[model samples]
Target: MTKLKGFGFKRYHLILLGFVTLASIATARIVQLHIYQHEFLSEQGDARSVRNIPISAHRGTITDRNGEPLAVSTPVVTLWANPKVLINQKSRWSELAKVLGESEKSLAERIEKNAQREFMYLERSMTPERGQAAQDLRIPGIHVREDFRRYYPAGEVTAHLVGITDIDEQGREGLELAYNEWLAGVPGKRQVLKNLRGDVIRDVQVLQNAKPGQSLALSIDLRLQYLAHRELRNALQEFKAKAGSLVIVDVKTGEILALVNHPTYNPNNRSTYSAEAIRNRALVDVFEPGSTVKPFTIAAALGTGRWQPQSTVDVGNGVMKVGRYTIRDVSRGGVLDLTNVLKKSSNVGVSKIALDIGAEPIYTMMQQVGFSTDTGLGFPGESLGYFPAYRRWGSAEIAAMSYGYGFSITAVQLAHAYAILGNNGQSSQLTFLQQEKQGPSIPIIEPDISHTVMEMLRSVVEDEGGGGVRARVPGYHVAGKSGTAKKQAASGGYTKDSYRSLFAGVGPVSEPRIAVAVVIDEPREGGFYGGVVAAPVFSRVMAGSLRLLNVRPDNLAQQVVKQGQVVRGGRS
Candidate 1:
């Protein structure tokens, strides 16, 4: 052995000392790593491969009263990319662009533009198969995220009621928007192991479990919805109207059974979307109700104990001067009872009745029947219709208000008013949700007054000379009123040709079950009168709905009599 550093020390001793120092350093490092830094190092390693990713929650399903699905959420996948990493995969750009239905140049530019961003959505709401194809490319930084897409099964038939959702499964309009939070579920998180390529290796642990959204059941009947939709669409086409709305309410439940609008878009088809087409016209569009308010006027007069069903009013030559305006009827009406006034749809008669009853009673009647207020359905963008206060009433204003002019109301509101009459003057809050327990109803008017008004309205539909003869349904008695209001010109006054045809009614007068209101805006073809254009639609829809609801016929004897069959001794 040779001596090196010290004179007394041998070379082997020096070598042994150097070996001991190296072994001691190695031993100290092992102890430090195993005892002190173990937790920190493990965390760092796990951070590289394990990720806490959010789990998409399932959205709720919306069903009609009959349990028919109106809107639903289906599983889908979204493709996102880490722009910083994806920018390097230039060779696979063309394949990615092809799968995304985008130009390769645009895709490249987007990635370059977002170079600083670690994550960006490449494509959202892709079908599972398409997303899997993109994932199969194995391009680094490209990832598939689980998501959901909203589906509307009834398409345009239930579009306005069920509404549509955005690509992210968020409700955008109609009832969907009103109930978004209830329908949107809580997303969860879990730790997952992934490889360097960003493909998930395994689920490490569940941090939180996803909470699925709650299911919603609407009060609508799908069968009646389809029927009303078909009839209103047909009427709009036949009349060449700009737009239309129809609403049906169960008189017993105060639950909206069917609500439909023309010029509506399919919620399922995003390409068919338009601002004008998406409006729920039944609740949003307001219009003067025209002669439809005559029955209410008669009811008001009756409530005053000054007029009876047979009380007569002189509508001389179908025209009368009130303030500065002249009111007229469809024809010369000399003397008319309250029932005949409704049967002939006399504006002058209602105006005389309003003048005699004063503004307070008429205004109170209108206000109590839901005019000038939203129906409390909690629908988004519902209008509070314009109803001038009684204190603001002049003679001219009162006259115009009598015949359903100088004020405005939504179709649903008008339907609700008629429903109040059908419910024997009992008024309840309206709802779109199926009732587990219905709220208590309040009396809007005396039951006798309501009954008298209902009988008068029945004469308007059933009598041969009645204005709403077309609204008659076979084997059932219908109580309703027809209205035609001239639209106000954009400049001033009223337009010469633009008109809104409306028909509001309740069916099976002996046992009222449904109240319906129809409004056709700007009908340029066919007959524009409410009786001609709107009543037929009301007839068809009411007939089909009554049959579909399995309502017993109240006028079967009249139907038999019209069919020339006589019933004797309980035999037909």
Candidate 2:
């Protein structure tokens, strides 16, 4: 009894006192250290006891002007591992890999790498379904993290314009690559603290808030894009062409309504990738432009006071010897003036205009109309078309270039050049993204000349005997140019049978609003003439587009007009 009474203290009280005394001592030590060794304590805490907390933020959304989501973030799961903990559940390794779409060895390697690190990722972007399945399996040391994956709802139809992103969420192509800074938001960083067990303490100090990416509203219209894609795809199959491209832009706004290129790949599924198909041909490829360049040359000549739509030039039976090479027309000529020259796309008459204007003058006009210069469309890899400097050009070059032969132009350049006509001889930057509708464009060319060119182009569509009738809609007026250019062989000479058929136009002529360009590359078999191969496509596209755009039609006047009172065969 005396021995037991010696301590006179209960075990529970002693335990409590021990805790209280330890706390007091710890407090004293902290207070003393705060007075003397504050920096040292802070450094030690920073080394081991400190925690990191991450603040969540949203990625940007890419949408059409109508708020239709073109590119959006879909939730994904990232599988993480803690090697120390994972080792305890090694038995589940083989099973885990099957669910994760990875090899067991791959998973083992990921876990083993982090034997020292507290946490590491086994995989970065696993689909949500598989991640959830993994969680259900309840394998140890495994964690699923939430992340955003960019998804394109419109698929390949919009891929070339909207573009794709890498796994790290960087812009890769097209507009995405061009305006990356605007589209990408700042990533948030958080410092997280975990115990030795790697369990969250639930007391997190947020370091930085992630800035959400900006909302990108594109000018492209979804409906128009679909229509362009559908029509171009149909043309590819129907014509058995090597490839095709189409671009539609609003004349008033300069906004790109739609851009389509076939042999496209869906960004969502990368397995179908082909470099040839992935390119935005409308903006990237340049060609001699053939007869399509005729209108621009005519526009230039008219603006410079050298010619008029009613001006006459003898096209002499469609065959003429200029120097050594003979230039021939698809349709042999009559006494052609500006109108029939464009309608028949006559090389003979147009060459004469080019000669009048001088190759250098028309070449300068082409530059003014955006040839051989960037149009600043905000599309990745867009190129300025090729036109030789006046210093480098010869008289033969100038003569040949008059009818769209010596120089090359991209489809967009042709469209832009034609847009100057629609914009009343004003050239604005081509925009793939939408832009505010402008009032009237200041003249990039003489409006008087543009007016005549417009009139002549309208006649091209209205005249049934000429090549452009198929491009005419019954009620709406359309003005455009067509080209069937000789294709250069991969070897050296031009291919006798191969031709690049293209149509570039602007329409609802009464109140012209859109400038469209279609290029059917190597349409090799079906009709080689621009009117036959490209004009019908132009017809289907312009008609459907006008109807969709809600443009008013001038019906009775169009029907009552003299059926064949069309302007024919005139020089520029």
Candidate 3:
């Protein structure tokens, strides 16, 4: 009995030893995996399921000076699918195509064509509701991704100035392109766990945070923009003009209050965008300034100390000989003072004055007034119009330039020059951004000379038989110049019937607050004269802008007197 008992105990002990050995082996393997091989295994698993996805950042908002939103980014959705996985779910393609607004056969061909590509865009920039419908269909391998679409609230009214963006929300023109770097955002990275079918199962980690673009505040006023647009459109339709442009600048601050062009396109809807319609004509198109250059010519002559505002010149028979070309006035202003030379827009008188003062002084005055140079607005396609060097001027060239015929300038450039005149001959660098400080003012011309020229310009609007009488405002002292130039032909020389009608002016002459410029291209109705076609636009825009800004009417006394006279007449 003792021997049997010992044998049974030995058997039980052997069984217990075998069980301990197996447990020890299993524990050793587990330790090796958890400490030494763990990183490799985790990497292999991640390779199959983890993906680095790009996170889109929101584009910046563009606002006017008054905080009105001009451009904004609205949320949208994009539907994408993994072609390899999507090809297997062909049965659901018809339903998916219905939501995507594509035919089932087209969708099938697209999926087949990109079967090797793991991902393909099924639909881009769809509404949230459509995206949700696509998601609710719950087709395997199909997914929704968030994106943004650019929206323009002001539409075509501010199209040329504000500009437009592309499908990726990148600025393509105008202020948008000018400040693209400051307005574009940085995209981020994220790690997500995806299934074999390319469906995102869960988010693993936020690898990087997206930084949204900064907003831009422009100096443009929506009220003035609308007013300018309305008036310019009216003038274009009324005169049956081929094209037109209007620009309004704040005299004191050098801020562009309004810029509008005809044949404008809606930035919100670019289904039929064209290069011509998208062009900001006021800044991009250049033309001969014609009689608008008369003021500067008179100012240059005055600066020579040889001529006074009352100085008289003999415009013999309203015609003068300059080399082979003959300069003539529109009418016979046989003898006129310097002020009347501007008022009458005499091509003959101004040419004679320019020849007397010589070319260097005229060129110097032109340069000071920001001619033949960029306005420094940094706008894309902004032009620096052609102004020949003084060394190239002969008698004919001098005469042509004197009457504003030899050179070219954009509408904005003309407005800027007028602003300098209105601002007491101080040049403030032009900008589209609101002025943070007053900015350093550079003296461009003698303030007294500029004031004298301004005074002479007033006669052009206020006096009867003046060329710019159409520019007269009832309650303000309007000072301006009118110009009519034949358009240069593409081959050479000037076009016969095509003319550029221009008017540049400053309002409330006692305390100049705004400078306006209007250009009408090829007016086919009524008359093509600057006074008849372009001056009215400047007058209407200036009057509306002054009232909107609450500028105290400088002619309030005159208005009251006129009202009193009318009342008394009615009583009588």
Candidate 4:
């Protein structure tokens, strides 16, 4: 019995030793994996559950000089889905389509076609209410992402100036497109843990921080914009005109205060968007400026030292022959001084003056005043109106150009030119942004010569039987010119019935605070002359703008008398 017990003990001891050896080897294998190969294991684990997610940044806001919001971004929700997962949730698609305003069949087809795609946009830019309702369904693979949408508070009133953005919140036109880079924000990235259903479980770490877009302040004044829009709309409706545009600028700063177009589209609702409605006509469309160019013509003539504002020109029988074309005046002003020539809008007289000064000087003056060039507003599709090379001009071309016929110019260009004249022949570039410091003005013409032209334009408004008499403001000295040009046909000849009536001028001429330009296209019901169709718009807008700026009235005597009358009536 003693011998058997000892053998058993030895067998048991051998088994125990083998078990101890196996336990040590297993522990050593675990230590090797955890201490030396931990990085590889961790990477594999992360690959299965972690993801890099994009973080969207908010776009910038566009405001006016007064800090009024023009274009703003509002937070919204965008719904997306994994097509492969959504295709299986077919029964829930009808409810999803109803909320998205999409037909069930269409939504089903889109999901089936994009089944291979992990992510697809189910609905973009949904209101918070609609997004919540959609989320209530609790369907798998459906996701809601926070996003932004652009909103224009001023609506169609400032549409053309502020412009619109696309579905992805990208600027498409106007100031929006011009400063897109400055207004677009940069997206960011983050590391996150996702569940088996591809839902974000927890945020792990920030990979990159989002950079929000910077805000932009424009030079547009909301008050002036509304006034200009209202006046232009009224004119279009009253005259039964095809289209019209109005622009107002601050003469001292060279900043565009207001720019409005008729037949404008509501940026918020683009269902009826058309090329005509979307076009910024004041900056893009060019027409023969007619007699509006005559002021510049007279200025060019006076610069030569051979002619003065009082110089006489014989407009014989109100007709001047230039090649095959006959330049005729609206009235028979047989002989008139330079000022009278502009006052009456005498085609023959101005043509004779242009012929005397020669084309090169006129072209040079036009170029100096910023004609035939972009307005420097950096707007998209801006027209650099046609000013042909002086070397290519003939007597007829010069004669036609003298009365504002040969060359073409945009409405803003005409306003800019007049602003230069108003600014004492000092030329500065126009800006869509608020000017912190006034730019140095370059001398374009002699100050005395510009003043002389300004006085002559004032005569056109103040003088009886003048073309721009209707443009006269009650108590202010208004300096401006009128233009009526025949529209050129696409097939190559002038359209007889179609006309572009334009009036460009400066208000409170003694100090010249504001410059306004108005263009009425194809006025059928009312008279098509610039004096009749466009000057009144200029008068109302200029007067209103002058008052809005609180500019000290140059004609305070009239204002005082009017106030005195009110007091006297009260006393009585």
In model 3, how large is the Cα lDDT of residue 380?
Answer: 93
| Candidate 3 lDDT tens digits, 476-517 | 897999889999999999989999889999987999999999
Model 3 alpha-carbon drift over 4 Å, by segment: 1-37, 557-572
Q: After best superposition, candidate 1 residue 157: deviation in angstroms?
A: 1.1
Clashes of each: 1, 17, 0, 0
lDDT of candidate 1 over 377-411, digit per residue (tens): 99999998899889989999999999998899999
Highest lDDT scorer: 1
In terms of TM-score, which candidate is stronger, 1 or 4?
1
lDDT of 2 at 499: 83
Preferred candidate (lDDT higher): 1 or 4: 1
CA-lDDT, candidates in order? 0.89, 0.78, 0.88, 0.86
Which regions of candidate 1 fall more than 4 Å away from where they truly are? 1-34, 101-103, 559-572
- Candidate 2 structure quality by residue, lDDT tens digits, 1-572: 87666556576679899999999999999888998899888888766755664444456888886789999877788878787888778789988889878898987887777777767777777888988998888766777667778889999999988988877677888777777787777766666665655655454556777787787888888888898899888887878899888888887777788888987999999897778878888888888887777777887787777676678999879888778778787677789888888877788888888877886668778888887788876567877767777777666777788877777778777777777888878776666665666644556778777878888888777776666665676678788777778888789768898888888888877788788898998875656677767776777788788888888885546663345564332211
Lowest-scoring 10 consecutive residues by lDDT in candidate 2? 563-572
Error of 1 at 131 (Å): 2.1
Model 4 over residues 245-324: C-alpha lDDT tens digits? 89888887899999999889989888857898999998888888888888888889999998987789998798777788
> Candidate 2: where is the Cα deviation over 4 Å?
1-42, 53-56, 102-120, 127-129, 132-140, 437-440, 556-572
Predict model 3's lDDT versus the native.
0.88
Model 4 steric clash total:
0
